[model samples]
Target: MKRALVLFNQALRWHDNLLLSEHAYFDQLIAVVVLDPAEYLTEQYGIKRASAQRLQAQLKLLLDWQQQWQQKQLVLHLRIGDTTSCLLQLAQQYQAQSLIAAEPTAPEQYQQLKSTGLALRLYDINSLLQHQLRPDLASLPKSFSAFRKQREPELLVQRPLQLKFSGQFYGETKLALDTVSADFISRYHTPTAALLNEAAALERLTKFIWQQRAVLHYKQSRDALDGDWNSSLWCFYLANGSLSPCYAWQQVVDFEQQQMANESTYWIRFELLWREYFRWQMRQHNSAWFSKNAFRPPLDFSAPIPDKRFELWCKGQTGLPLVDANIQMLLHTGWMSNRGRQNVASYLIFELQQDWRLGAAFFEQHLLDYDCASNWCNWAYIAGVGNSGARQFNLIKQALTHDPHGDFVRHWLPEKTTAGALVHWPEAKVQLQDFWLPFLKQLKSKA
Candidate 1:
């Protein structure tokens, strides 16, 4: 009898998963996700690889999947420890011919999979138009615009495959919720529990496309720091494997046909292209993508580190109203709007003058929708040390534009009830020129 062992790296859902689809060809199939202790350990940035909020969200998703597989008379095994060894042991016990999984974007995950001494069949579960636009990784344009220009014409979001499984599989093991931290799920306020499963992802997809019809005004309101209708908010599921990008695109297409298609509708697809770009960047660069100087001009290695300032920024006590508010929201909910992310990331890299990687690490730890490629590459972009030129946001200007009435600030910081324009902005501790001047001088001299 043929048996298969599939590892749930990032693609955690059964729907639209290529690895799970192969279940039909195997007699007995076992699905497992290993909670490697190494991931929970602290990194060089002095932050845990994941925060309580992220851990809690993941745990809830696993639990839901466990109950789901259990009802189908199959076990969704949750193992803990060295991932490679765990999977190998499971393979030996199950007598599986080969291990299989969706390819992982993060360097660490790719490394772990390589370490596993098994015949592996990995599928690209992340991208949508892989077959249509298979650009050589080495030849991927450094600029997103260039990449988009070439691929946009051929952008074809494939229909998500509907796999038919026997609904019969071997193995039985209860989920080990205690293996992950309990702090993430307890006592903290989150957006909603609906964010943790494929069913919820589909629910959100319907609401965004039908009930709210929010795509009609996405471009106009995407900049708003708050509100549900302003953005699709699908990244939460996209970051996790519960929702496939193709599925999201399919829904977008349906929305366009059912409703009026406009620039707003196209903008959603534009954002997806950006996501794809980052994934390609990671695939090309691998672990090197996380280095301090990955794709841009080298930084002056003599600069002093700002540990205390970075800490303040991370804790949302930086005394900058807009930055603090965004950080506070992320700390509480493990989420922040894309606009909020750009502003805060700029503040940390340029204003506070902290290492960009440190900021990336913090986001990786906290954000519920964190994608390793997007998180790190965006940080590198804002720091002007990676793809494209340096881009810095004037915090005051951003507040005036996006949160003019300071409503977003007040919403998070209730203590600032008597808010005037940027009232929550404390007196500046570090003047803009302190960092800005050196950056300008370097760029000017280079020019």
Candidate 2:
């Protein structure tokens, strides 16, 4: 009897899952998810690695999977502590023949699993295409545009696997719900948080692509700060692997074939490609991406020692109306719009004059849909310390363009609203007009 232990992070759903779909291959299989101790520890910025929202989402996801597998008489083990140690301990206890799991994108994570020296097999469950890019780090493209331009014409998105756990399997373990700390739950509960599960994820995708037909106007409204029709909100699912990118892509292709084929339809796929680009870049750059001096020639930079100002920004109290509003939204609901993210991140990096890594760590700690490559790379880009060119937002112009009516801002910043004023352009809280505008103008001119 050859048994296998499945260790997965990121790829958590069963529909398009690599290990769960192929359970028949093993005589017996035990699945496990370790709540790494690192997730609970505080970083230099005084924020824990995982917020209550993220922890709650994870708990829900695991519970959902456990209920599904329980009907089949299988058990999913949920443990806490170091990732590598947990997997090995379980493997030895089960006397498993090998480890089966989805490949990890972050280099440290990938290396951690590989270093176990146990027979391990990993799958690229995160990617849409069946054929992965060759493992040639040095030969990879230098930029995202080049990668997309060269690959989009030839990329093939595979159909999702239709799985059936028909074979006889292990059925002896007890099922139980692990206790999530009361303090954690009490501190992070928000009435507006989205439910985390495969059913909810699929429903969101269906609504966005077909029922609401929001894809038709995604190109135009994607930057809007509020409203469901503005964006798909699929990142939460994609980041956690409850939704499959390939399945989403196939749906878009089907939509175009049956409905109308336009830039909006193609735009969704373009965004997916950007995600793929980051994954590939992570593979190429390895762990170096996390280093402050990862860039070639190293960016000439300095950040003020994190102080009260930095702390205020995190609490959404910096008092710049637009930035404060976005941060407040994120704090209240574990989510924020793309435009909001860009604006707030830019303010943290340039306006607050704080360290970019600190901001990245804060997001890593708080964001429910956080992805290593995307989150860190974006911070590096905005901080002018990435391989890709820097992006600096003109906050004044951006607020005027996206929230001109003040509906988005007012919803999050009611105090900023003036009863008769046409727009809620609140005065800047800090006195920086003397140099802020000219510095931004110079940066824009250079770009």
Candidate 3:
């Protein structure tokens, strides 16, 4: 009997999953998910690769998938250890002829899959644009506009695949739950906002586009620091592969066709293209994408020995109300607005003069919707080391423009006595004068 081991990493959903749908012909198939311990261990950056909150969110996704598959009389083996070793051992025990998985954009993940040295069938279902139709990496555009111009005319998003199984699938094994802890499983089994399955993802997409008609005002309110309908909030689902980009793209196309076609509708697709651009950029630059300079020539920049400033920035004690408020929001909740991200990134790189990678690492640890390519590439863009070069935002100007009434700042940072624009410039207040004076003097001296 032919048997196959299917590995589920980021692509956790059953729908639009080419890895499982295309392999339905196998007589017997065993699905496995391995949780790599290294992801929870602290790295040289003094932070865990995945924070407790992020792990909690991920476990929730896994549990949701496990329950759904069990309804179909199929078991999803959950293991904890080195990814490649676990997959190989499982394949050997199951006597599977081949391993199947979704193609990974991250270089490290690609290397891990290749190291297994087993017969592997990979599918490119994670991205909106299929791998075969993507531009040659050697000549890929260096800017988002150039990339969009070249691909928009010929944009093709395949219909999401529907999986139907007619073969004998493996049942729960003795070793299925041996490696994982009951407490760990039970902790996330209870419901919370982070638990998002494929069904939840689809419901949210419909609500945003059709029910509330929030897509019409997305361009205007997307910059708000905190709101439910301001942005699509699809990143959390897309980041974990619970929702397919192609599926999301098609939904927008249908919305325009049946409802209305405006700049707001067009901007939704534009953002998706930006995501595609970063993924390809990461593929093209590989390790250079994570380097200190990031696809640019080396500079004489060095992080402080102790990095106390970074610590202050992370803890929301920067004395800059707008920046501190944004940091607090991220710490309290694993979300941040796109405009907030740009301002805080500019503050870290241009105002604070700290290493951009440190800020990127901090976000990786905290962001629930973190995509490595988008996170790192954006930081590089603000630091002037990325494809589009440097982008510096005036924190004062940004705060005044976006949060003119200081509502967002006051909501997150309630300790401040200053009101209106004074909240953004704490140095202007006599009581808080000493708090931000040093930073202002430092900036002046640097100038």
Candidate 4:
């Protein structure tokens, strides 16, 4: 039998998966998902590589995919252990001839997959632009503007593959979920109203563009600190591969043609391009992307041994109201706005003068939409280590501009009842002085 083993990496869904198309030729296909334990272990920075919330979210996606495959009479075997070892065992057990999977963006995972001496077929289904069309790694642009200028002319989002498998299926293996501790799940599980699946992803795209007509104002409101419609909220789906960027791109194109073509509609594409830039950048830098300096020279910098400042920052006890509020929001909900992320990241890297990687690690732990490239590259960019060096935000200016009325801060920090602009400056209110004075004085001394 011409059997193939299909591994679902980042591209979790079945709709646009190129790997599933191999079923047409293969006599029997084994679908598998391997969850590496290394992903859940705490790193040297004292942060889990993947947080409980993110793990839980990923598990939900896998479970949903399992049901979808069952409907088509295919089994998605869930395995937990070393990915390479699991794949080899399964391949040998099933007597598979070839291994198929989506191209992983993370350097470690990418290298691991390549080291497996199997007849492999990998496809780049996660990105908006196809892999072959991208610039050579050696010649890849260092800045987003240059990248955009180069690729915009030839910009083409290929149609997602439509694969329907009706061939013979491989039987099930032992489910690994039974091995997962209930304590781990319960610890990280915060009930969310959002559905993390392909069907829900499609429904969201339709509702955001067609039903609410919100994409029309996306450009103007994308920077807002908080709101349901301010942003497209597509990042959650895009990060996990529930929604293909090509599918999203086509939806926006249809919206522009049928309704109205404006800056708001175009800005959505612009943001997607930024995401594309980071993905390619990660591929170019490889292991260096995760380094402390991140493709840049290390500076003479050392944080305090105990790193009390970082602890305060993580807990939302920092004197800066805007930063603290955003941190609190992220801790509670596993999400924050783009504007909030930039501002808080700036505070962590510049204001506190802590290691930028720690801030990135914190985000990786808490952010529901955390993509490895996007998270680490962005931290490096803000810290002057990545492309387009050192973009710092004036915390007070940012708060005044984005949250002029301090409604966002007050919403998150109910104790900060100081009306109007006073909420942004905790030092102004007598009640907050005890906590604010010491931090403010230390900052001034450092300056």
**Predicted structure with the largest TM-score when compared to the true one:** 3
Compared with the true structure, what per-residue lDDT tens digits does model 3 show for residues 1-447?
788888788888867777666455588878877666666545646766776777777877877777777787678887666778878888788888787888777777877777788788887787777865767889999998999999998887776766765355585656565445445566544466478668888999999999998888888888888888999999888888889999998889999999998888888899999898889899888868777788776642343233777788899988788889999999888888999999999888877778888888889889998887888888888888868778888676677678876789888988875656556664432133333455444444433
Clashing pairs in 4: none
Worst 10 residues of 4 by lDDT: 427-436
**Candidate with more favorable, higher lDDT: 2 or 4:** 4
Query: Which regions of candidate 4 are displaced past 4 Å?
Result: 23-25, 164-168, 173-194, 297-306, 428-447
lDDT on C-alpha atoms for all candidate structures: 0.76, 0.73, 0.78, 0.78
Could you give candidate 2's per-residue lDDT for residues 1-447 as a string of tens digits?
Answer: 778877757767777776775565668777776656566454544667777777667656655566676776677776655677777877777788687777878876787687666688888888764555433557767787888887787776777777774353453464232344323334444544456767888998889989999998888888988887888888888887778888888899999999988888899899888888887777777666666644554543343268888899898888677788888888888788889988898888777777788888888877888888878777877787757666778776676578765677778877765532233343656655543465435434432
The lDDT of model 1 is: 0.76
Which digits, one per residue and each the tens of the lDDT, describe model 1 over residues 14-122? 6778766645567777787776657755564567888866766776676567677778767877765678877787777778767778888888887788787777778
Q: What lDDT tens digits, residue by residue, belong to model 4 across residues 1-447? A: 888888886777657777666456678878887767677665647766766667777766766677677787667876666788878877887888788888878887887677777788878888877865856889998889999999987887776667774455676645423345234444544555245788888888999999998999999999998888888888888888888888899889999989988999999999999999999999988768667678665633332232888888899988789998999999888889989999988878877778888898889888888888888888888888867678787676677678877789999999999877667774532133343454444444432
Query: What is candidate 2's CA lDDT for residue 401?
Result: 73
For candidate 4, what is the lDDT?
Answer: 0.78
Question: In candidate 3, where is summed lDDT lowest over 10 consecutive residues?
Answer: 426-435
When summed lDDT is taken over every stretch of 10 residues in candidate 1, the lowest stretch is 175-184
Q: Point out where model 1 deviates above 4 Å.
A: 23-26, 166-168, 172-195, 296-305, 422-425, 428-447
lDDT of 2 at 369: 85
Let me know the TM-score candidate 3 reaches against the reference structure: 0.90
